[model samples]
Target: MFMRKSKFRHVFGQGLKRDQCYDNIRITKSSWDSRYCDVNPKYVAVITEAAGGGSFLVLPLSKVGRVERDCPLVAGHKAAVLDIAWCPHNDDVIASASEDCTIKIWQIPEGGLTKPLTEPVVDLVAHQRRVSCVKWHPTAHNVLLSAGSDNKIYIWNVGTGEVFTEIDLPDLPLSASFNFNGSKFACTCKDKKLRVYNSRSGECLQEGPGHAGAKPAQVAYLKDGLIFSTGFSRMSERQYALWDEKDLSKAKEMNELDNSNGVIFPLYDADVNMVYLCGKGDSQIRYFEVTDEEPYVHYLNTYQSKESGRGVGFMPKRGLNVNNCEIARIYKLHNSGLCEVIPFTVPRKSELFQDDLYPDTPSDTPALSAEEWFGGKDADPIMVSLKGGFVPTRKDALKVVRRSNVLDKMPTRTSQAQSTNSEAAAAPSLPPKPSTTSTPPDEHVGFDPQGILDDMRKLKLIVKAHERRIKTLEEKLSQYEVNTSEEDEGKA
Candidate 1:
């Protein structure tokens, strides 16, 4: 039997033992369409159901065992968290969108959560309705994109807490993905249309019909200007399609898989050009090799399991075990409150580094800044070699400088007085100049008394503003105290 001579043909999935898996977790039961989980080399975050608010649990990758019943949670959102994404440049930074109609960015400590994390570093409040999705830019630092049920898409500069760009869609976007360079993105919407748009300008360059079925669909932008999507057919059968960026009016290749009701998620690895299709509530993961050849998409293999998965998260390439010939790792969330670790490895007899299977992959360093990406500048992702294994660089703290009103920037009266005193003291005593030739008003050498008066007026206004702000804060504090007392009384 002559098989397709490919490096990934012998790839097999190996599941870790029960002791190595994370157990006793309370995964969310929200009907929202999301992975509900995100994994990095350092930690794994899973959304859990909370009583009065939404929360997620962050666990260290090394702490693989039964989770404690009273584990600390990242509970900042007043409503259920719909989606979450980890920043590519910083492992400790994450963004979460919630049904509270807001998106919050959180920073975890190096050792994971020691107590309940109730505060977020940045809170973005622009969506008029519940936010459904959040995605970090692939190659830019401090850049994030979010979609809301209000039919609006916002690109944010997380560092400065300002919207870099905005895109209005005809309908709610079901799924969205950024291209290699962060220059463009493709989206699948509830209107059953696939559209590609400019990331900065928000111009729709291409639009076409998507899957005919009414269920949710997912889209992923590939390396060589290709798009992969998965959705249900008109007959309710699950199907996947490949499309050329130049033409979306028709799929380059479309194939039907099964009649499962769960939505299929297509995860693409640009290094190997392989796409893994994992469906919610399905026990198997089907992967395919995408090429520019006749068939375009080739079926590689499937990894089967007995327990069904509620959600799944794929780890980055740099986290794989190169010595064990591991190419990819997936963290599968089971309905039984267990997170299983599955590693996909290519069988090989060579004891040396296999160059064929491992190429230069995307490094953690970002190639562009949010300002550059929003200013019409584009660059591909920075790549690094994995021959000697991966070592992460030290990341600085994520500082969020929010936008403020003009009054907030005004100098205080005490500082202004200090500046005036300093200026007067630094003046060289000229022994009273003898009131020399009558100096023209335009060429006056002395400080303007009128200007001092203006400064005094401005300082008074600043003082009034500060007093108003203090009074407001005092009122809020009193109200909060009253509410707390009432709540205590009710509990008693």
Candidate 2:
């Protein structure tokens, strides 16, 4: 009764009640699997792998602080379902990979799966080891990638159930992710190498010594052909690094952090140019701002909690409430219930902030089928209305952090990141900067059309030069084969 509520002025720090959690729910493991989804926006998916691995539960949050659990259990994997992803092109359809060494794609018939959906529409089996992870291509339809402990990454076309290609890695892959355009991807491997792949040709675009230590690392792509990774140092301390995709030998920035045994999972927000690093078994999330300049990983604040998080889920960009100036929302899985954590950025409670930040987000209905996605087309997400279109105003929306002990569970904000010069800041990692910056205004604002066109031309030339190099290498290898054949005949 002594703690005052006025201090928590902006952050929405509410915890899910007992009923909000899926009854008798538990997660599989948090080592490399982040098993939570808001792909449907209206409904979120969480793996019930703790039930010994056959199914998952989809909970719809159409109503505030309430979850719909009547949805059917998606079952088919003979073994524990390790990972599942909602197709970006088709909201209802989902893809899952299992320890059974197979991948299955299921469609969420309207009103959710009513029966014990026994079979998936498409089943793919090729991985020799347990498929640990699966990721859908950001801009491509029906294109999916799977990573296995067998040290292989497979790209597949779910529609045809055919393997598009496979990339063999030097070590076992811990995780994999695609860039914004789906033309490239980055994966963190157990051997401590971060490998970037060309999605179009399945070529190893770049491989570099990633994290400084022997443990597994996490990698995420940033804007403008840059990548950032989180891992441990040689001395078993937590450290993260940023690198230019073009040059693997030199790093743009690398910093050692307080050593924690838990592995840090890197999640990137492309719209805001920020990356949130969540550690395994840790309650709070450490986020950083990624700019095109130096010291790219500028530490933001941490959303601390009393309960150590077991697993976490990130809501898709389009599913968020822009009217609240919401940047990103995270659902953390705890032993008892799921907590919805939303980190926002609003400058003062005024109509000006609303008009400036609350622009219409992409909500057009997506292609209904994988066939439509294969057409190489893009569509907006149909704008979803929450609470029957009654938008919550700024003060009305800021939720109070609810815990058994509200005062103790309140998040402690700090700044411990470095400045833009690659030097750690005097004290806090990241402090609040101006809401507006020197960033260029877009055409939606004041973009330079000529400058953009010039940049495209330069990129086109680079692609052509790369093609020429590949052709020359192929020709040289062919000639070498001819010479070796003649030498063998002479010897005979």
lDDT of 2 by residue, 1-492 (tens): 642222123334344454554444545543554544334555567776445456776655543354445446788788877788876645566788788777777766655655767656556666768888889876544678999877888887664455667777888888888876667888888888888887656789887888768877878887688888888999999988998888877789999877788778787776556677777778788777776655556665677778787666776666666655665677776766554544455445643334433334333232222333343444323333332222322221112321111111111210111012122111111112213476444546555453454344334434543575588699999999999999999999
- Count the clashes in each prediction: 0, 14
lDDT of 1 by residue, 111-196 (tens): 89999998665566667799999998888767899999989898976654556777899999999999988788999999989999
List candidate 2 stretches off by more than 4 Å: 1-24, 29-39, 50-53, 63-71, 337-347, 351-492
Candidate 1 Cα errors over 4 Å, as ranges: 396-492
True lDDT of residue 467, candidate 2:
70
Steric clash pairs (candidate 1): none
- Number of the top candidate by TM-score? 1
For every model shown, what is its TM-score relative to the native structure?
A: 0.81, 0.69
lDDT of each: 0.82, 0.62
Q: In model 1, which range of ten residues has the least summed lDDT?
A: 401-410
How many clashes (backbone atoms < 3 Å, residues ≥3 apart in a chain or on different chains) does model 1 have? 0
